[model samples]
Target: MRGGVELTDCPAQVSADFGGDTVADTADTRTPAQIEADIERRRAVLAETLDEIGVRVHPKTIMGDAKARVVSNVDHTLGRAYVRVNGVVSEVKGQFVDAEGSPRLERVVPVAVLLVGVVGLLAVGSRRRGGSARRRR
Candidate 1:
């Protein structure tokens, strides 16, 4: 009880009078039983705190927390990307469709024709290659 840890009859009053200092200059007035009880309570609290610290520093716990953070970040990034792509698609569609949602034939026809031309060229190129290979064989 050299420290102010000695149980006081009026701890609140003692703290208020002494600027809330836990160490007091007063003599230990707690009975042996009271001191023992206080020690036991302090030990239990200390043990619980140590257990919590151990769990917090454990490798598995740290890994789990890191994984959760990574997953959250990835999900957030993918969600934003999806929103941006959807916005781009909507903008492109808007350009090809009018206010009434009808296809702008002028714009649609040109794009369709361009795609068809590309596909036709690829098919013809492949067929020529195949025919030449067969003739060589």
Candidate 2:
């Protein structure tokens, strides 16, 4: 807690001070442009987090406010909220608790990074083969 203010995972408490939630919902007074931008950013983060977590966020339709979804499939429970644009998510966020019920040790993985690494290795191997064929000649 820097300066005596503590950081917490509760959205309601944080949102209350901010006049409105920038989590589950957008600030109503914010201009449409501002809200749209916020939504866009949130969606990107949500998609990335979900991808990292290795879960499918089934496509859904939403009109204005950003939507947050909570799922409890594993020992961990997640409460994520994000904005949407054009039937697609624009923002995403959540909290995590590991199976051991320990707050400090949460589980997360980098699926996107793994996929990229795998693809990079395959490309490198293919290129190496072509180079070897030329060198043999």
Candidate 3:
């Protein structure tokens, strides 16, 4: 019964302003049916919003999101590692090969000799072990 107008007389007369809160608008010309329809529409929107929130909070949805994040991070880290290793390989290749793609014989020859010597040593060591086992038998 505000200002002699009963609250039931005009439901549209009561309106809420954004931020400013509730502000009565006596000039609102919307009929009861329109107001009812609007309320129903808002209710449906709210129900959909709640359903979406429910899905987002579900355990399976949360775990899936977490797994996606982990996989993305792992991929990013592996990509960085690959780039670093590639750079290292390029530097090593540069050391053993000239800009014109010719092998630096001075560097390559020494490394090749060292590898061959190591392989020969391994082969001799294995033969010695085999001989010792045969002697014991």
Which number leads on TM-score?
Answer: 1
Candidates in order have lDDT scores of 0.82, 0.50, 0.86
Provide the lDDT at 81 for model 1.
Answer: 100
Candidate number achieving the greatest lDDT relative to the actual structure: 3
Candidate 2 C-alpha lDDT tens digits along 61-130 = 2311124322242213322222224224212222333446444222234545677899999999999999
* Model 3, C-alpha of 43: deviation from truth (Å): 1.1
The ten-residue window of minimal lDDT in model 3 covers: 1-10
Q: Is candidate 2 or candidate 3 better by lDDT?
A: 3
Name the candidate, 1 or 2, with the larger lDDT value. 1
Q: Give the poorly placed runs of model 1, Cα more than 4 Å off.
A: 1-26
TM-score, every prediction: 0.79, 0.22, 0.74
Clashing pairs in 2: 42-90, 42-91, 42-92, 43-90, 43-91, 46-92, 82-91
Clashes of each: 1, 7, 0
- Candidate 3: misplaced stretches above 4 Å? 1-30, 134-137
lDDT of 1: 0.82
Off by over 4 Å in 2: 1-27, 55-137
By TM-score rank, best first, the candidates go: 1, 3, 2
- Model 1 error, position 101 (Å): 0.9
